[model samples]
Target: MSALWRRSDLVRATGGSAHGAWQDVSGVVIDSRAAGPGDLFVALHGPNHDAHAFVGQALAAGAAAALVDRADDHPSLAGLPVDAALLRVADTLKGLERIGVAARARSRARIAAVTGSVGKTSTKEALRHVLAARAATHASAASHNNHWGVPLSLARLPAAARYGVFELGMNHAGEIAALVATVRPHVALITTIAPAHLAFLGSIEAIADAKAEIFDGLEPGGVAVLPADSPQFERLRARAAAAGATIVTFGRSATADCRLLHAVSDLSGSDLSVRLHGRMIDLRIGTPGEHGIANALAVLATVEALGADPVQAGRSLAEVAPAAGRGARVPIRLAGGEALLIDDSYNANPVSMAAGLSVLGRASGRKIAVLGDMLELGPEADRMHAGLLEPIDRQDVDLVFTVGRHMQALHDALDAGRRGGHTASSDKMVPLLREMLRPGDTILVKGSLGSRMKVVVEALTDGEAAGVRPQAN
Candidate 1:
């Protein structure tokens, strides 16, 4: 691999003092355990733990260098080798930000920043997948869209990259503002506005306003890709316009610049007919559900904004598959037959939960939903949990299993026939679910990260199972 940061460039970018003779780093990582040869391990101090304690471990694991703010006299640096390649900065986090800013300033890549209540990671991945098919593309790894994740991802951008996609996430106001300023994307996309982070932002409108912060850091004459179907469309448009962005909207709304004409969804994926600036294109996305279609439209709009071939980008959607814990499907082996598992266990909200249920509703087999509590809904948490019953009934889900205290609302709301079982935690649900699942059953597992719904997914797929298949992108 080509060097991502030479010693001189690293020193200049971060304004740090080099202590040893490491010449170049091929990669950057924050975790010591993830460190590899030629990787620069940045020691970040978090509220829970000080990564400075891991610098010795990172260097011992073959890291090219370690970025640190601590002195040799510091207890954490006690075991670090004297000859260890090191970059000593006043503040490692700020140093990382400086390196990111320097990388962004030097890169020629057309960058797109995505932020929203849901689908931030999926949409970012979609953008990366399509754009990479046309050019050298760089993107934030996983859900690396926070204060440090944004800067770390930016710092990792290769100079040769033609396109860069970034996902920016936030639970409080001003978070995206800070992160976006570092990204300064040429195109800023908001997937959709939903009641995520309601505990922090309070209302859906407040959530929209927090998300609009992505526009504040747009480069000159940047494009703002928005969801026209959202109630906050006008609000987001106003914010984008105020930020001097050229607005591009996508949705089923006729006025959307990238408008959806028709969509056919199934257990596997969706076939979408879309109109982009009066040019109609048909796209087959491997990711299932209407939510996937919405993400695809946002991606197409972003492709257009980035001056890429929309047709080629749309065609690339055929290869896009859902990442694990974000809609990847796995078939589990049973004594009787095989049961399909939809693992949407990464995170959840009212919007995403309903979307998952809708996807489950499309399955041919005995449809089951193993749902956990959607966290961070604030005062309406119970009401929001109970409200899922509407979609559960509408989708005709054959059975439902719920986990967590909040999910108790949905469990109680379910009719006796539909109520499979309810548990206060995921651990309890695992055995019950494993025992109850049978052949030809399509089970959809979903919940917020805090709710630990992945336990149920792991339990189902743990033993005597077929390997996971990418069902949706």
Candidate 2:
């Protein structure tokens, strides 16, 4: 592999001493399992385990070099008989930050940073797919958008990249500010604000402020893409204006630059039309949800902000499928026929829960919801969980199954005819849910990451024995 970093660059970027022969690597990895012959392994210390313990494993897996902070009593390489390099620094994470900063500085790529209570990963994936169609684009993989995730993505950025996309996430205040500063995005997008991390941040207003922190890292005269329909729109707009960012809005509102004209949906996807700047562009997305339309608008606005063809970006939407756990759909074979399993068990909040309910409302057949608790809701957890009662009834869902303590509120509030079952734990609902599902039933499983609701999604989609009982309308 050609040098991803020069000797001088590594020294200047990390301010660390190089003790062995060094070579440029093609890839960067933190896990020993992922390290290969031409990879740079960064040893990061965490709560569960220390990467220092895996340095030998990384080297054995054919890593070219390992970056470490602990050198004294570090395993000696004298008898290993392998040609490996060891770069020592005072602090491993800070050293990584330096490398990320260096990576951004050396590259001329136009950067876009995204943050939101929901849809951060989905929007990031959409941007990656849309942008890659027009340039040498790089983006955070999966949901890698936290403290280490942001820097690790930046550090992995290739110098030849033409565009870089990053997702920033936080459960507390001041987190997005620090991450956006590192990204220094030319275009920053806030999908929307909601009461996701209420346990840590306190109020929805505080969450809005935390999400607004993404503007602090915007490049001068850069673009701020926002959701025009969001209740926190004015707040985000004010913050963006204060940061000297040009504002562009996208939503179903009249003021939005990228305005959604209409959306027609089916099980496969949605055919949506959005007015970009002044022209109306229609696109079909392979995901099923109104949130998909909203996220696509943000992508369109962002693509235009970066001087890319919004038309091409819109075209790429045809290929944009939902990411696993976020909204990936699976088919389960049954004794009579088959059931459609919608896997949205990744994460959830009140707003996302309503959105998922709306998706269920539009299903072709019987609608069922297997909901788990929304965690980190703090004191209003019960009230927030109970708030779903209205949306559930409005959706006309045939049956509802619930898990977790907080969900008990909604289960109790639901009409007895609509109540499928309620359980203290998700595991106990597996057999009950398995027995309840019928052919043509479209089931949506969703909850916060802490809820572990994906287990039910797994049980259904893994083709378990379909000793099923039919349900009456």
Candidate 3:
């Protein structure tokens, strides 16, 4: 951005010409709402909308430059500054890819990438907490771990960052490996690959194979942090070994480099006693899930691998908190009294659902589970949902509610005597939920993002916290 970006650079990156005047861009953007001065807005086409339609709005919103698929037909062609750049490409995603790779090349930080069926976002948050207490650390914002997200996060990595964390995610095979190939990580953490994304990967073993691909991007002598209790530990261990990287284990196991000696998960927060090497330290996760405790151990190990103080790193985890719609607790007012709400409505698979349910089970008072369908299960969707009946029954949940097309299967699978009635929409669920509510009831809201279960959580709770859209400020 110091000098005018050469037309040749954009041309070479996307094989497109600077048919319009070239300008030096100071920043890159996707959303027209957040566009700023001297920004280059890339108009990405999506299922429901075309970003090309908003080029004028972006330009009006102080965007100095823009990129689109069709250069000649763009409406803002006449308003350009003589030096303004018009970047045209075959695909806007591909053009963003070029920008991202170029930005990564400018950075000198020690990049660490994490992936697993669960806990990727939480572990990444923990990484930022521990690493930032000592150095200038930049990490993926939320769960920015997909195709476009990976490149976009990599592009946003500041060149002056001392440490970096990238959370890579995939629902299908070859996706993680493709991403890993781009942001080469100094330490790759596989929290644990459980039965997730089964529709695309076929089985848990296949998911393990895909999760092991994190090692594909490791630099020589890089570390692979594995959970000792994970059923797939040996598989990942062999894979990391074959990739010529060392392994740092984390779990309750004695052999682990970073292990949890005691974890007390409660409504306030989790009090964790962790063991690193031969030393033991006390730490607390500012969230209320056992899964959060496990994730903190991974962050603790990552800090040690990065040569930071383990005790200080562990203690710093208190600064980390859950994102909205991911185990974020809210208290709701019922007609009779109040109930605790655990809104984990962002995304769900078997592992995260079970973890959330377990955390809710441990809370005080009567338990109410309002669950929805978990998508992308392929063939095992029904059995998987049905498999929760025993756990719910054993956990002594006092009431049950459900929504979505597939959740009805789980609703019917429950015992007739224990059934509290079911509704396929959270709006329609008001009556039964009202009847079931009590002073000390604890309600857990969970489902895949597509199920819109967060709406159900919103209905129960007062809007004191506003909404879940995150901001950079």
> On residues 1-473, what C-alpha lDDT tens digit does candidate 1 reach at each position?
78999999999998889987699999999999999999999999999999999988998899999999846676898777688789999999999999999999999999999999889999999999999999999999999999899999999999999999999999999999999998999999999988888999999999999999999999999999999999999999999999999999999998999999999999889999999998989989999987899999999999999999999999999899988899999988777568899999999999999898889999997899999989999999999999998999899999999999999999989999999899999999876776677778899999999999888888778873333332211
Query: Which residue pairs of candidate 1 clash?
Result: 287-473, 321-473, 322-472, 322-473
Can you write out model 3's per-residue Cα lDDT over 22-89, one digit (the tens) per residue?
45666667888878777778888777878877777887787767787755655644455555456778
- Candidate of highest lDDT: 1
lDDT by residue (tens digit), candidate 2, 1-473: 66677666777899888766766677778888999987889999888978887888888787878888845555643344344578778888999899999999888999999999889999999999999989899999778898899889999899999999999999999999999999999999999888898999999989999999998998888999999999999988999999999999999999899999999987678999889999889999887777888899999999999889999999998999987788888888777888888888999999999888888888878899999999999999999999998888888898999999999999999989899999988788899987788889999899988899978877777767366766655
With candidate 2 superimposed using the best TM-score fit, by how many Å does residue 274's alpha carbon deviate from the native?
1.5
Using TM-score as the measure, name the better of candidate 1 and candidate 3. 1
lDDT of each: 0.92, 0.88, 0.79
User: Could you tell me the TM-score of candidate 1?
Assistant: 0.97
TM-score of each: 0.97, 0.96, 0.90
Superposed model 1: Cα runs more than 4 Å off: 464-473
Ranking by lDDT: 1, 2, 3
Model 3 Cα RMSD, Å? 5.2
Ranking by TM-score: 1, 2, 3
